[model samples]
Target chain A: SAVISQKPSRDICQRGTSLTIQCQVDSQVTMMFWYRQQPGQSLTLIATANQGSEATYESGFVIDKFPISRPNLTFSTLTVSNMSPEDSSIYLCSAPLWGTDTQYFGPGTRLTVL
Target chain B: QKEVEQDPGPLSVPEGAIVSLNCTYSNSAFQYFMWYRQYSRKGPELLMYTYSSGNKEDGRFTAQVDKSSKYISLFIRDSQPSDSATYLCAMSAMTSYDKVIFGPGTSLSVIP
Candidate 1:
């Protein structure tokens, strides 16, 4: 099992502002992912953070809006640019343990854009 | 249809009652199944995980998977008020890059 920590557990931001959330893992992991959970909705995959490379984003999400960075195996960050009320959601970072199907999640960063 | 389907139930039950939560999927290739518990304003915590089809028990929680029916369930015995939260079911295919499809969580409230 792996432990993950995310910064800015909850934040309230104004519209058009940007907020960057950070995630750190206790151990080196091969893969890391970013997810968004809107109120009362299921989680949507945002991107896969690869160390030393560009992030692979899922459909309907782009780098310019939700940029990601994986500087190393244990740390990554997601920046929500030009935020809006629609972007009010809980963003979570997850890491899958090597050779396993389970993914451990961080405490999550909740952003509220007003 | 979405790959996974689950009843987003705000199911309420009295303490010590048995609570059942379930999900269904359309992907036949999903070989791994898992259950996650999320408290209000908290990230999801892994409750149980199962590969292939069968039942796995841990303490008061039991997870059952029926691959043939494409159904999975999490049963909580002796439910407690602290157990109130949303339960999410997730699954993935082997060839996938550990990218799992999550179901809309079922909100369960074990009322005292």
Candidate 2:
């Protein structure tokens, strides 16, 4: 099992502004995942960030819109740029314990764009 | 069709009653199955995990997987109000790095 934490539990932001959410893990990991859960929807993968490589984004997500940074093994940040009401959702970060199929998720960061 | 399908139910049950949640998938390659419990406005917490077929029990939670039918279930015995939340079923094929697909969770309310 792993412990994960995210900064800014909940925030209200205006449209067109950007907010960066941070995720930290207790132990080193090769990959970290970012996910978004829109109201009444399932979690959609935003991207997968490695320590030294560019984040791999899923379809419908772009680096310029939802840029991610993984500076080290246990820390990563996702910046939501030029936010809109459509971006209002809960964002979560997860790390799969190496050598296992289990996944650990952090307390999500809820963003509300008005 | 999407890889995974689940009833996004707002199922209500009384305390001490049995609660059952289910999900189905089109992909037979998925070998690992898991259940996650998500509270309102919080990230999902892992509840039960199973590999391949059969049933695994942990306390009041029981996870069952039927790989042949591509179906999975989570049964909560002696449900409590604390069990009120959304239950999401997730699965992966071969590795953790693989694209893990999550079902559209079922919302459950265990009345006190």
Candidate 3:
């Protein structure tokens, strides 16, 4: 297991504003992923943050709405742009540790777009 | 249908009671199965993991995987009030490490 940390543990933002959440891993990871968990809902994959390349987003999500950056193997950032109340959810970052089948998650950012 | 399905259980049980949690998956290609426990206002912590099929036991928790039925289960013996949390099941294929799919969590409350 790796030590994963996320910044801005909880934030209340106005609609139409943007919030950036940062993820840092204690050790380098092979792949990084962003996920969203709505209230009383299952988690949904938002995108895969690839180092030195554009993030690969899942269906119903686009880069313009949730742009991500992975400048290095140990760090990544996700920005929720033009937020809405519907975007009120917990955002998390996770990555697979080397030679392991399990993926570890950060504490997550609780964003409330009011 | 979703790739993984789990009952959104707010199951309440007394302390020392045996607890059962389960998940079913539609994708047979998934090779790695995992169970995670998430407390309120916290990220999920990996509790149990198994590859292929069979049962793995650690401490008071037992994880069972039945690939033939595309089902999996987690059993906790002597449940504690501190064990109350949302339990999530996750899986991944051999194809990539970034495509792990998570099921809807089951909320459990073990009252003392």
Give per-residue CA lDDT, model 2, range A6-58, as digits (tens): 99999999999999999999898898999999999988889989899999999
Q: What is the lDDT, from 0 to 100, of the residue B106 in candidate 2? A: 96
| B-chain TM-score of model 3 | 0.96
Runs of candidate 2 exceeding 4 Å displacement: A98-100
**TM-score for chain A of every candidate model?**
0.96, 0.96, 0.97
* Candidate 3 error regions (>4 Å): B95-97
Best-to-worst ranking by lDDT? 3, 2, 1
Cα deviation at B96, candidate 2, in Å, is 4.5
Residue-level lDDT of model 2, residues B30-106, one tens digit each, is: 99898999998789988998888999999999999999899999999999999999999999897533477899999
Worst 10 residues of 2 chain B by lDDT: B92-101
- Backbone clash count, each prediction separately: 0, 0, 0
Which tens-of-lDDT digit does each residue in A1-114 have in candidate 3? 469999999999999999999999999886899999999987889999878888999999999999999999999999999999999999999988877767788999999989
User: What is the DockQ score of candidate 1, to 2 decimals?
Assistant: 0.54
Show pairs that collide, candidate 3. Answer: none
My TM-score estimates for the predictions, one after another, are 0.95, 0.95, 0.96
Poorest 10 consecutive residues by lDDT, candidate 1 chain B: B91-100
What order do you get sorting by DockQ, best first? 3, 2, 1
